[model samples]
Target: MSSQPDLFDRSLLRSRRQRALKAAKPGADFLLKAVSADLEERLLLVNRSFGTAVDLGGHTGLVFKAIEKSGKAGQILRADLHIADPNQSPPDLVCDDALLPFGDQSVDLIVSALALQFVNDLPGTLIQIRRALAPDGLLMATLPGAGTLTELRDSLTRAELEIKGGAAARVLPFADTRDLGSLLQRAGFALPVTDLDTITVRYDNMFALLADLRAMGATSILHDRSRTPLSRQVLYRAAELYAENHADPDGRIRATFALVTLSGWAPHESQQKPLRPGSAKASLAEALGVRERKIRE
Candidate 1:
């Protein structure tokens, strides 16, 4: 048996980040501006003054426009596998692992969108996020969840099996909401919350979506045996499978992005110091709305 190569190498992360930037022609500065404005609203709800924001794994400058519009971005920081284009300066780009970065309890809010699913060490990354947050600070992040790219995955599998003897060795893994919430809690975040949003995008055809992915630099860098190129035949068959099986009416194909957004808070010393023993303990039966029963030894 042969050992599998690391799919989440630094080089691979940088390549993906670069691809994401090249491919993302983010529509509407107003849109990202709206997102920035909403961060202010969310900050109010979190009951914390916005001090600083970090864009973890942020590929392009879409979020920076939002920060600029927010007018509350004096200390906004952008950290990713690759830095932003040097000409743009609103976001001070630092290339580093999202799981680790500068200064402890220094940031008031961290907004990471469409980024966490790519990290191999997600829980560790969350822990790092907690460390970056000030007391009473919040971390808001969105990640790809299960059910995202199911069609593409299915088609790719079919193509690989038909052409090669087995399935493709590499594919991105997404986390589920429950697991993600638990991870945030383990990372020492309090009041962890997870919400799911499903966005269905329509494409003229399957090939169009594939092209969009390529443009978005969302291509796979995890070629364990990338020397084995994806032949035209396999790509054609994959397209056929997608158009035939995954098409909607009007001959358009659909792609679903299952985005799971998570939020958590850094602990305040006052909040932690007030807990009393057995203050909120409950039996499993009580918690689950079932009658308690004695167990036999």
Candidate 2:
């Protein structure tokens, strides 16, 4: 099989993440912490416990801390592309987004938050993750969906096209809900489920939104991103368009973040499987108390 296309620059991604937490302190990673907390809360609703867990691409250990608090795993290991502060707890493994340093069928659970969207080879990463899981092992992760930053993406494209007579990629691509499910199945995971939640945040202006993205280490890092700096004229026009199109009643602009949550399990004989066709004992018409008409062969 052919290899997956390289989409992101790993070194640049690591630098941005390091810079984002350079002024690190309590609550510095506010947005990441919020999403990690939400993901952990939802994971707990599944009511499953694991003996060993790994938090892949866990920036600043926020998601790992959440996993620790749930008491769902006996031993929790942290992995990421960057090494965290020495004063803080160090990670168990430091590696690239698409690499996994674990034995096959060893981990009982794996959790990632706001990280997989940057992976250059998501299908390969998912396959590695599935291979690392023990039988019936669970994987729970959340990443920004396709609808994230729609307003900004639209505004930027229009402004750049109008000012420069062309446009370069400013926003990175996101995974669609169907694509996530297909990847899980392709990776040989069982009982996969994927869903999305929309979170709308209001910013005073487009600059504020951009700054927040920068602080969160979420700015564009696509491999094909434009090297030249954006012109001030384009930036100003983009801001004006954003405010005009997505402004709230209070004059603040609305930014939409669609978070996609995915859950899947390592294949196991005990897990539920779909029955074969023509095996059902009851008919839909009978169940609904309606007449059933058969077409002549």
Candidate 3:
């Protein structure tokens, strides 16, 4: 087990997710809908079908629905901290994202959408996922990347500094795309790939954006978050700052959501491997049709 302290309040996050599900309104899951479509598109590109697929931390089964619609996998299972609706088809596995329960080489595919970002120990979780996958099994997931919510982060920081004389951690820290790619390699995944897609949403004001975040259960649950509620003055000032800095000509403020997609396969002997350093058949100079200039030691 890692000795490092938890970055997010997982208990709080679970409760917040439950609350959000109870109060969810139409259009509250717009981000999930967009991510689900992207996941389906990516899955469609893969030619082969999977025997058993697990939806890891899939909120409200959007990713599961996507996978089912694609007809790419058989025996789909949903796993989450809690079932969003007991009346509906309950999740097959109710478990935390950080601690997966599966035998070695058990699952053929795992898909997660906008869920792994809140995990306290993402690297460990990735390792566990890799261990749970069959040889050549695939993992595809999407989460908010480093550039997400920059406007709101800046506005909140400035506002808090001006009003409270200091700023606290108001936004959750997101993983960088390169860092996530490196993690896939570290977790022993083969043919790892990471890509970014920026989604910009325009809101009438910062408050509207905040409301949407709350509805999505995406509000900050950082373990070190300030206990005191944000003052109305600070909130209004942040809104004003957001408009001044990130608003469009039409007076609508823009919010950025940087989605980072990750894909990798559990290592297998049949997968492609890189050639040895000196195994190239043709020299670089020959390939480029240029005279090689050696660097002086």
lDDT of 3 by residue, 1-297 (tens): 868988999999988888888887679899999999999999999988999999888877788899999999988998876455543487887988888989999999999999999999999999999999999999999999999999999999999999889999899999999999999999999999999999999999999999999989899999999999999999999999999999999999999999999999999999999999999999999999998788972
TM-score of each: 0.79, 0.95, 0.97
What lDDT does candidate 3 reach at residue 165? Answer: 95
Q: Could you tell me which residue pairs clash in candidate 3?
A: none
* Regions more than 4 Å wrong, model 3: 292-297
Query: Local distance difference test, per candidate?
Result: 0.68, 0.87, 0.92
Clashes of each: 2, 0, 0
Whole-model lDDT, candidate 3?
Answer: 0.92
Q: Give the TM-score of candidate 2.
A: 0.95
**Which is superior by TM-score, 1 or 2?**
2
lDDT of model 1, residue 21: 60
lDDT of 1 by residue, 8-43 (tens): 655676765565565555541222334444544554
